[model samples]
Target chain A: MLDYKLLHALATVVECDGFERAGDVLGLSQSAVSQRIKSLEVRLGQPVLIRHPHLAPTPAGQRLLTHYQQVQLLERDLRGSLPTLDDQAPRLRIAINADSLVTWWAEAVATICQEEGLLLDLVIEDQDVGLKRLRDGDVAACLCATPQPIAGARSVALGEMHYHPLATPTYIERYFPEGPCKASFQSAPAIVFGPHDQLQHRFLAQCGYHGHFPYHLCPSSEGFVRLAAAGIGYGMMPQLQVGELMASGQLASVAPGHFLAVPLYWHFWRHSGQLIQRLTQHLSRVMT
Target chain B: MLDYKLLHALATVVECDGFERAGDVLGLSQSAVSQRIKSLEVRLGQPVLIRHPHLAPTPAGQRLLTHYQQVQLLERDLRGSLPTLDDQAPRLRIAINADSLVTWWAEAVATICQEEGLLLDLVIEDQDVGLKRLRDGDVAACLCATPQPIAGARSVALGEMHYHPLATPTYIERYFPEGPCKASFQSAPAIVFGPHDQLQHRFLAQCGYHGHFPYHLCPSSEGFVRLAAAGIGYGMMPQLQVGELMASGQLASVAPGHFLAVPLYWHFWRHSGQLIQRLTQHLSRVMT
Candidate 1:
């Protein structure tokens, strides 16, 4: 059996990103926090953290952290059954893609969270990489493009998020005067969400343009759409996010028929508590 | 003088987060990219990269990268005068806080971007830590709470962002039936943006509450507002973001008169090109 107090100190250190901040949160001195970490390392006979350039957990440290988080979830379940436990609400950390959060995710989970008296810690990542958060045990659940679940985890298919290569009417008239073609695509600028986002690259490939093209990288979902609408660049806009804009003629598809349908999946621990299970079921129903 | 080609390789490696991807983007073989990095390091007589765990630049590498990016900016300015230079639009990377991005940022720079035929790479970061991006050579400019600029950079005041502790009427009725007091604040849930966000803690301190309180950690600016309006938790809502909601009677101030005024500043290199200077002037005029 492991000492939960020591594990908690490790978790807090990672969560706070420093021993000093962890001490502030845990109501202990910085040296005391350091002492606890040292004691845990002494017990385990290995270092759990890489303390130089940046504070990150080692592989062994990650496994222990994941175990601690899972135990915390089970304890929350136990607290639910026993009304004598403190009435503090439990927080569920989820790694979700930005497009989902900007469109359907908040509304889908809002009711359940409010009813269950649950709190959330939402970490936004690109769909292509969100699964890593689940795999690393950094989050209880995640929404990603990948359907495969890691060990001790389950994945459920959510519906596809259709993306259209969209731009303002003025932008289209200026850049693609003869309509979208290989030549036009090579010249016209495009908006990419970030380095991790491959939607535009894939969409362009589907349009038969594999050559290098210029692009603006905007990390914010709202800002990406706004840039496209302001004639800064055309981009692959998610259907759920741009439906109203498309209807209002604010944005028009640069490629009329060609679209990318990215399939989303919900991944969570197989042995998660009832709240997570319920939330998973609810998302599977409404998301599709 | 350092070879721009080698510096370009270094920048591409960091940008892509891997050598293979950087090779693909640079149209070089993986070994060629590796050779370029090695040659650059040999010339410098020190290691530029820390390859294990993660790919990050050493201090010397960061200095070289910053110098390379500044030269790129100057070359872009030179291209404007030369006109015969390939007509690729210059891309300016800026680090901005989510609140500013969500509210005032895009609109402030949209016209300038469109007119200048410039593209943007906007990196979203918390205001408290955004200046680090600028200092680390990751961004050409940054919007942050810090008033002082780093060496070779300039800082301009951009006015204050007022944050009010806001909650729905029903949430207030349930959590603080009488009125907001230390006891209510102790038990009631709060919405914090992330670990770096201290607005709520500062606001609570001002309200005469210095005890530990439960909070939901939300990293997205739009989602944070949604969570607050959904009645998940009361949070320090930015005045620019919640004005419409507050006026429509959806969100109300919990403490009535109390608010947090976080002063914002724009930090950029002192020797930037005309485009950056124009942007600085534009932001100063409108953001205030």
Candidate 2:
């Protein structure tokens, strides 16, 4: 049988970036932490981490970490059946992108997590990176953009999030009075979510404007909408978010009938309990 | 002089994560991209990147990438000085946190970027992380929590962001009817921005609750506030944002006399021009 303390020590060191800090967290001496990792390495017959530049797990260490997390989760479930553990509400950890957190997620789960007396530990990152956290067992489930499933995980399509290129009427009048063309699109300022955001680029690419054009990055999803509505710059906004602005004429669709749809998927561990089931059911109801 | 094309290739490879994708970006064969990197590495006499896990630059490569980015920015500025380039307004890139972006930044710069016909590129991250972007020359300036000045950069204090431990009256009654105590605090669900968020922890520590208690992660600052206001969980929120809700009794300070104050600073490149200076002045005026 593998010693869980060694596995915990390894994962903590990788997360903390070094043995010294991990020792502080684990309440052990730095040398003690090192010894534990060494013991684990001896048993596994593989070096589990890279020591230079930064402390990161090797593929073998990653596999062990994943196994350790799964076992811990299962143990929590097992504890739930004991009368003494009944008072401790099971906490559910999830990874999700920032946009979803603001748009609909908080409102969706506000009741469930509260009413059920369940705790939630959310890890927020970009959609792609969020899945990496899930695969590494940092989170039990993830709402990701891609549909690809990891080992021992199941994925469900959450439907496409449709994005429309939109701008204020005044913005359109100032920049694209003659309607969007190569020159107009090139010269006009645009709004982007972040550096990794490719929606604006993809939209412009479809318009045959592939050059690096100027843009204003507003990282807040709601703030992006507000900026676009205030006539700062044109941006791609989800259809659900832009509906009111479109009706009010605060935002006009730049490309009518053309939309970029990003399909999102919900990925979760196959052997989940009441908490994950409830979360999945709630997300399916609200997201769809 | 160093060939900028190779520097660009190196930076692109790091950003794109592989030679194959970097080749696709530069419209070169994968082998050719690999050869260019190898040549550059030989000339530098140091390996610029780590080959495993993911393609990330070593410290040496990061230095080179930073230098290349600075050179590119300088060239863009130089290009703008020509009479023929006068019509093309200079684009100013900045890094800021999401809280500032949504709170006041988008509104504050909306007029300047639009009326001045200047483009603004805003990169958002946590305050400390944003400063890293400024140091790496990804942005011209950054608003950071730390007042520490980077090499060749000037920094000014921007005032403090005060946070109060808050919850809805109904929530307080349900979770801590008597008042916030160690037991009540541990049992109550808390809301947090992300893993890096420690405002809630500090507040709880002040209240004598230091153990690993339950928390619900709401990544968006606004969403965090909304969840707290809706009785989902108590959270630390800025005083400016909670005023109206507090007045209406929709939210109340859990620990009335306690608050966490985070001091902010504006940091900019020492050798900045009209755009950066104007932005610095504007933020100084508004943030204070």
Candidate 3:
């Protein structure tokens, strides 16, 4: 029930960071772009953008952009299927987290892109926030940690991302020679992915360390593992990644029988596109 | 010219998400926390908190939080140096990008943390934005790409992170048998790190492909290289990382002689702490 042109104008203004630049991209005059955004705002009866600090969309504006992106995706998909339309390759926008992108997901996605002659635009975010991007319509599909499906969306369980408390043998010997007790756990530092990443906190809380503890925040999975291997801090590591280190005695388990298993899901908008179907099939087949 | 206590109150409220919870964390009543925030808002003569769409700090609020965090870091460092200070290890926050973290940076950092009995809180962001954290006082120091130093900061040129456009030979033959041209560049997919990452764009622009092109976004350096090796897409890779692979013929340069040499600098507050000095010395010695 909204105008695609107006919605695009709004999204482009945010993306371009100025009306003049958005105009250049959309082939409209600066005033025309401004007027289109103004018209859209009037239609919605609310402001869609915050003008200062940076050109960013308001919640309502984000919702509108999401709608626009969804419509654009479906239309593009439809156009790709109709042989009479054009031979232009279709671009597929996807939302994913850093962890999945680095591990098993990238290979599967790249193979598909090459074979199908599809263009992929990947929006990388934390798994916790990946689904929010999907809800906002910033990306047509997302791989996230949330197991529950959003309304009018389809979700497929991609199995658990198992994490165990791992530390270098030297770090364990230096900090927890008596094993990982509450006392040593408090004194020893832990590595965290980011402020929002609660993997270490969850594991510690499960191990009964409820109070504030020292931590080193390494925001990348590979970097975090490298730090853990170098005796910087004890933190959780995925089973697949830590197995070799554990076997080689470079890294050791902090606590026996205590692990955090984060369940992951792939969520996509309710659509009937062959590409989406094939992508889903390919992911489900390979991820498990 | 701002009260650190009030700023702390505001930051805690934003971090904790509710007045009651923030009050619990600060050991104050909910009304006290609210009154402190109100007083601070009055002092600033601007609304600092957004009451709707979940609790978020306004631009002004974010600025105050940055100041508060900076003050907190200095105070903690000061206390750690005092003879009366407790034996608890101090946390040192820093800003860096993913590539540095995954490569040579992590080892040196972990060694410093282990030796100094300090906790590192690394804020990972692109080199372009890494200095912003230093200005905002979110981190005491940052590893960034900016050659010019901010006010009251000292910069040390470490080295250049040289990147070359790399891809598998098979992909090169299939996509660009005629060699690198604007047409082949348009049709062939390129791997990008993230939406914010412009390495590929810079390279393409250098190669005369000024328009938009198909791309696969792989957020990790390691994963990006994996995709390139698997013939998913040609992307920029650091020379140090791709050297072995290139030697083995698993990967080859897309366009020889065309590379991006990103000069990296270490920027830090003009502080005289032995720990900061030692850290800087250690990093310069290792990275250079």
Candidate 1 per-residue C-alpha lDDT over A1-288 given as tens digits, one digit per residue, 9 for 90 to 100: 899988999999988888998999999999999999899889889998878556878777888888998988888889889979976677888998888877887678878877887888888988746677788888899999988788889999988889999999998998899887988888788999887788888987887789988888888787788778777889998998989999999999988998989988999999988889999888988776
The best candidate in terms of lDDT: 1
Judging by lDDT, tell me the better candidate of 1 and 2. 1
Q: Per-prediction interface RMSD?
A: 1.8, 3.4, 2.9
- When just chain B is superposed on the true chain B, each candidate scores a TM-score of 0.94, 0.80, 0.81
Model 3: per-residue lDDT, tens digit, B23-60?
97689999999999999999999988887545677778
Better of 1 and 2 by DockQ: 1
True contacts kept of 2: 0.59
lDDT, candidate 1, B1-288, per-residue tens: 778899999999988878998999999999999999999999999988878556888878888988888988999889889999986677888998888878877678878877887788888888756788788887899998889899989999999899999999988998888787988898788989888888999998998888888888888777788777877789998999889999999999888999999989999999988889998998888877
Error of model 1, residue A45, in angstroms: 3.5
Report clash pairs, candidate 1: none
Worst 10-residue lDDT window for candidate 2 chain B reads: B82-91
Colliding residue pairs in candidate 2: none
For each model, chain A TM-score? 0.94, 0.78, 0.85
| Candidate 3 clash pair list | none
> Against the hidden reference, what TM-scores do the models get?
0.94, 0.86, 0.89
Candidate structures ordered by lDDT, highest first:
1, 3, 2
Give the winner by TM-score: 1 or 3. Answer: 1
